[model samples]
Target: MKLHGYFRSSAAYRVRIALNLKGVPYEHATVHLLKGEHRTEAWRARHPQGRVPALETDEGAFLIQSPAILEWIEERWPRPPLLPEDALERARVRAVCAIVACDIHPLNNLATLGWLKERLGADQAAVDAWYAHWITEGFAAIERLLAPGPYAFGETPGMADLHIVPQVFNARRFSVPLEAFPRIRAVDEACAAHPAFAAAAPENQPDAA
Candidate 1:
């Protein structure tokens, strides 16, 4: 498998965590988003959306969308399962993942930030304020939804936890305060202690350059 990703992309970070947790061996193909490589025709051929973190399988399958790619990884390698077997448990986990993936992430993605700058004439401070506001609102809800444990759902880390870890990492990069969300902070801390999360961190990537 080959993963085309940018080191700082939160979506790419999520997929990296999922792959590492599943113990999958994949070659890295760094697509520097800052250099506009993701927008190039060569990269666009793999994912028309021109997004980072597209996975190309040995069977010649290419996957776009971080959520879909993660689900595929979960299905292919189920040992340290990310989703629970029970339907209700899975729903709960999905809800948590959605809070970050759909609600928070989309609003603060690089494209959106660029739009705010170019279209709205927003400065860096304004863009950062926009980012923090959404993250604060989203994380407050996530804190309420979390069970008082190491992970989001329960005692063990699961799909929701994987998504949460990267979202929090992004939040920190933007200087968002974690003080108001104790449960979310705890979950992120717990995840950071795990090898899977540690190994998948952006700073640990060989091509973080």
Candidate 2:
């Protein structure tokens, strides 16, 4: 498998962690998003939305979207399952993943931020504020949603931890104060110590700037 991704892309980062946790070996193809590589015709052909983290499977299947790719990875390689065995626990984990991937991440992604600045005439300060506000609100809910853990669920890192860690990385990148979310912070710190999470970190990516 080959993953097309940018170093700092949170969506890409999630997929990377999932692959690593599953003990799947894959190659990395860096798409320089900053250089508008994702917008080019060549890239669009590979990914209709021209997004980072498009996975080309060994059988010649192309998978797009971070969440979809994650689910695929879980189903294909189920040994170190990313979801809980209990139905309710699985739902809870999915909810937490949705909170980060659907609610928080979309609002603060590169496209949305660029739109706020370029299309809406918002200045840097305003854009930064918009970024931080969504993160704070989303994180508050996630803090309450998380169970007691060294990981997000219980003893092992699951979907929630995979999603949250990347968002926490983004939160800190934007200088969003995280003192209010102790549970979230603890999960982030815990995941940092895991080899899977640490290896997939943005700084550890080959394309990291």
Candidate 3:
């Protein structure tokens, strides 16, 4: 498998963690978002949306979107399962993933931030405030939703942890105060110590600047 991703992309980071946790070997192809590589025709051919994470499977299937790609990985390789065997527990884990992927991440992604500045004429302060506001609000709900644990859902790292760890990394990068979200912080710390998550970190990526 080959993964086309940017080093700092949170969406890409989530997929990387999932692949690593599942013990799947994949080749990395860097798509430098900051350099506008994702916008080129070459990338558009892989993903119509020109997103950073477009995974080409060993069988030659192309997959896009982090959530969809992760689900595919889980289905294809279920050894170190990323979801619970119970239906309700699986739903709970997916809910937490949605909170980060759907509610929070979309708002603060580079495209959205760029739109706020270029299209709406928002200043740097306004953009930064927008980023923090969404993170704070979304994380508040996530903090309450999370069960007390070293990981988000339970003793083992699951889908929720994959999503949460990357968002926490992004949160700290923006200097968003995490004092109110102790549960999130704990999960992040636990994930950092896990070899799979550690290897998938942005700083550890081959394309990291």
lDDT values for all models = 0.89, 0.94, 0.93
Worst 10 residues of 1 by lDDT: 147-156
What TM-score does candidate 1 reach?
A: 0.97
Q: Which stretches of candidate 1 lie over 4 Å from their true place?
A: none
C-alpha TM-scores of all predictions: 0.97, 0.99, 0.98
Give stretches of model 2 more than 4 Å off. none
Per-residue lDDT of model 2, residues 156-178, tens digit only: 99899999999999999989999
Q: Name the candidate, 1 or 3, with the larger lDDT value.
A: 3
- Going through the candidates in order, what is the number of backbone clashes in each? 0, 0, 0
RMSD of 2: 0.6
- Tens digit of per-residue lDDT, candidate 1, span 131-155: 9999999898888888768888888
